[model samples]
Target: MNEEINKIRELLDKIEKKNDVSEDSLHGTFDYFELPQIIASVIDFLQPLLSPYESVIYWFLFRHSIIETADRYIRVSNSQIAQGIGSKFKSGDKVKVASDKAISDNLRCLMEKKVIVIVGDTNRDGTLYKINLPEEIELCIERMKKSRVENTCHVEQKKDLDYYNIAENRLLIFERDGYVCYKCRKQLTRFSATLDHIQPVSQGGDNSYSNLITCCLHCNSSRGAKPIMEQFTSDSKVF
Candidate 1:
């Protein structure tokens, strides 16, 4: 009687495996050793290979166990990927849809890297992607972060040259004009300050420090296409 009961139990187990379709069941059967920490590590490593949008899409798949987030009937396209990447829609027919291509390409790349696997077809409708964490992913993530930091540092250094030059010019202009708009005595913010040509650049004025004066935006805009002297005189105003 015990042997018959054991055989029945084995038959039930086979039925259970055959009928299971839930994500948990699939995971338990195929990747029984997977833990939340390992999944997180995989995402962290994958982040660098992806743009912000791609990273979002990749993680969404891992956490929810669903691919092709949009309606499958909508026909996955590149524009959808661009939408995910924050691009404005040109039209449904414009080029190819970005969302479909981006997801497909990234999935292929991830598979090639062995960070994930195609376990099976989804309900006979879509691909069942199983997530995995591998050592190369972690290493690749580290290298990408380092590259980003270096690139950021280089941009900052380039910007500093113009910033310092602007600062030095401000000091000289303040000394020359007593730190006020020549006409209004208004204090200037950086945007409010402008370098007006003493003589018009079109009328043979050279682009040199000595040939310019720091003027306010109000004065500059009011000056228009006319020379400064002509502008103030034409309007009969102090601007």
Candidate 2:
């Protein structure tokens, strides 16, 4: 009797894998605000490799699982997959769904390509599958990483000039010092604040980011060319 029961348990286990929570599903921290970039990455890197049917199914699954729900796992059956890719109903043509075998074949091909994975076995509802993003696919990772680096370098190129002379780069200094008068500890707005040199231009200061400071008009004109120390000392006494 124990042997028979053990065999039954084993069969049951084989039929239904547990629907345990997956760590990847729990990591729902991806910013959907970057959805445009993610979509672009998919178009530029992943779409070229997929066949017509695979592309359709992959996009369908992506929309339902990731875009609609913001999770990678979904429980769906072969019939549902076929129906999702139903034939067009234009001009009263009878609507027809894809065959189960065709849907199964495409899904198997995707799994072999490592674009998706079966996370749990079939049950009354459906089987659980995990959809891999472009970045997560092993085949796409190297290209995706390269694209991200190129974007970063492009942004870095914008800052490769003199900070004091360039209006955009000048704002960087004011923003860095928070648009405040450094000597007086006064808050300032963009229109009212001015950039001052710690080492006077007449002395040796060139227009680099490190040599610049934010100051109000009053502190700027009053401290002109005076040694930087005088601004900090009292008019009546020196420390």
Candidate 3:
């Protein structure tokens, strides 16, 4: 009886894939000439609204489906997202894949936010998804309008616009962390505060804002490549 159910499920998935192949092809002729503009919008607008996990999963799907192929539809699984996306936990010495349940929940959250749509049924291969671009998403559209982004097919990349390496993005992190050492609780200025990775980069941690913490130079250097320091009690502790 189990075997019969499995066969039926497989057959249905195959049929769904066959039907969606045309849907994918409809986008095959799409001119991706304006991709850079869309990329800028995703970075500047859409990304800020998504949770860290959702951002990682969204990028993974975007890279695999839209960037790798012209197809916006990609088939993926919760395990695939958990493994493919970069995340590290301090559970053990070795880097570990994020919990599958976290990925699944974030995927649902993304759908609820209308960032991605489930286009087809699931199978052994995985479920099919259609990634919605920033321009299509309501939140991004509002941001785009408020930013007064002119109607142009071309967009120039801004200086210091990316992660902590960039001046603008670094300032964002400092502001978010309140310019205080997350580990030692020491207050710091932008010039003295350095960003520390929650999960060390050596351990597969990413530069997402969620993974970054502000710390004084002493704490940043002292905690280098080590597990997070114990929460220090002295907010006014010097050095």
Candidate 4:
């Protein structure tokens, strides 16, 4: 453990000394893209929104630097991760070994949040499971790359802006709008309904309560990028 800590410290020193890296390089199994700080920032900002298993799974992918590829096509048996977590605790007397059931529950939580896609059963050949990061994660990855290039912490500020689109906020908006299309007054059973920014995101509108309105898929498509006021005044108004 001491040796591993020393190695990590050495790597941090190297990263602090050098600032050259690329997005592709960051995806490797052990490549340090000299943006550990930015990555850490993103994780810290997002950790509150993730479960313990979700956090572990994310770091596992990060260590391997396979977010994009994993999202495209990935697979891992439930038992594998469970065993991995168990092994991690075996060396520590104080840490409790995670049960298979606990690992399974976290996996389900991750799936429900769209953080990972289950490609197949763990009993299959490879126990395939694809990791699908949310748009916010992808944006964070991009911002990390940009920060490495620009040598700025602007990406940190953008984190809050991205938070507005998280599932919790979306759900709140859906509930506030009564899960019904504001224009057509059509009822929506659940998340199937679209969330239209009353002020339009393109026009600097936010995802706050005052700016959100629920709409059915058909109505949402018709509205497109047009501003709400414009839609109302134009013939495209669905109401």
Candidate 5:
């Protein structure tokens, strides 16, 4: 009887292991978002401002540090960046790959534009760079705000706050709300996210950051001009 009981236990363990494996195979291989999706917002915002070579180099470093290595910083040589991005040079007779000087110049240009920052001094291995997506976006927003404020009086600035549409402002709202829809409590990507006015503009809402909230398109549209506090109170959902 003892021997029979031990055999049954071993058979049960095998069945459980097989079920776990089957479940993992069915569901564990898929993910809704990856590195590319996470970085898509930065790309969309900066694409128009970057040159062809600058964009290529940026993507190469982004893939290496963020996608391939899952790191926020990367050490890379100018030659490596040039080769990875297919920068070319004109030699005496044929078109050769970019020289280190050309690559260095472009890297410096990126640094000047605040797109990349040098994190470490040049060493025998390579120079380290930290990508500056969020910082760059913030800087862009600040510059625009400053320009607007300087060109107009405070009253005009407050009345015409169209800068709310800027990428940086949107990102700030999303970050403040933990990237979840205020109404539905669903996670949102930069692409799928929209901003809603807690106080409807039709009522008295201005474009001040405090009056804006991150929301999904469905919630933003469905809310229409309804007061947020009333809706939340009726639904018994705490904002």
Candidate 6:
């Protein structure tokens, strides 16, 4: 019995040593934040007013500037926006591809709804869009509230996957992972981090919080469709 007890104690000690090494190695690679409560409030308020396409585009821009870049204004071309939101298109011989026209239409709609504004004149480069946060859209929120009351019975329900792509969920996943890449254990900021699925969607993974993790772009792209364990072997060095 004493021999067994000593063995167990030795195993526990080894585990603690390993944990200490991990913490030391990852000391500067993770960052923690007080989750931004405003993101949730903003997304909830706007969900009712936005069409599916509008919501997708808005969220994409929100992630790019507000979350990833930490900028109030983002300069983007219609082609860029279209690509980000997975807009479909087709050439004479090719299948569906990105549509810049669709992106332009959505931008115009968002501007008309006062959810975004053009910061300057359109130039050869691209348009600079100033994204309106929750506090910045008081009037639009009021109008949306009134419209919701008027059309209470006609509310639209979106899919779970779509909901997961909103700013709020993205923030939640970032916070949950301490803003570090799960695979490489590298520290990241809102602008530099991306959410990756432990199980690839093509392999039947869903977008639940349990399935999502914050990853740096390189690790996320490199680990595509590969098993998670393959990236974290004993011989691997994150740096």
User: What is the C-alpha lDDT profile of model 6 across 1-239, one tens digit per residue?
Assistant: 99999999799767744543422232333232422554664566675678888888888888876676555567778877776777565668776645667777877888888888876545455776777754346454464345445543332232254314776567656655556687777766555678887767888877776667788889888776965655677887643
Global lDDT for candidate 2? 0.71
Q: Candidate 3 residues 100-167, lDDT tens each? A: 78888999999998899988778678898888876557676567555543521122233223456765
Residue 233 of model 2 has an lDDT of: 45
Q: Residue by residue across 1-239, what tens digits does model 1's lDDT show?
A: 99999999799757644543434333223322334433544554466666665566555555444223211111223334345444445686674335566667876776676555665433323555554432224444355355445554454444224321455444344334433565565655232456666667788765444455667767766675556575455655533
Over 113-198, each residue of candidate 4 has an lDDT whose tens digit, in order, gives 65665544443434445443322243333443443445324423443443246654454444444456877877562325568877
How accurate locally is residue 67 in candidate 5, as Cα lDDT from 0 to 100?
64
* Global fold similarity of model 2 (TM-score): 0.54
Q: 116, model 6: CA deviation in Å?
A: 0.5
What's each prediction's clash count?
9, 0, 0, 3, 0, 4
Better of 2 and 3 by TM-score: 3
lDDT of 2 at 125: 69
lDDT of 3: 0.71
lDDT head-to-head 3 vs 4, winner: 3
Off by over 4 Å in 5: 1-36, 88-95, 134-136, 139-172, 175-239
By lDDT, rank the candidates, best first.
Answer: 2, 3, 5, 6, 4, 1
Q: Give the alpha carbon lDDT tens digit for every residue of 114-184 in model 2.
A: 88899887776678889876645656655644554565445445544677777656655665565567878
Ranking by TM-score: 3, 2, 5, 6, 4, 1
Kindly give the stretch of ten consecutive residues in candidate 4 with the minimal lDDT sum.
19-28
lDDT for residue 97 in candidate 3, whole number 0-100 = 80
Give, for candidate 5, the lowest lDDT window spanning 10 residues: 22-31
Please tell me which model should have the higher TM-score, number 2 or number 6. 2
- Which prediction has more favorable TM-score, 1 or 3? 3
Predictions in order: lDDT:
0.49, 0.71, 0.71, 0.54, 0.66, 0.65
Task: State the TM-score for model 1.
Answer: 0.31
2 or 4: which has the higher TM-score?
2
RMSD of 5: 13.3
Per-model TM-score versus the true fold: 0.31, 0.54, 0.54, 0.37, 0.46, 0.43
Off by over 4 Å in 2: 1-19, 26-28, 88-94, 145-156, 159-239
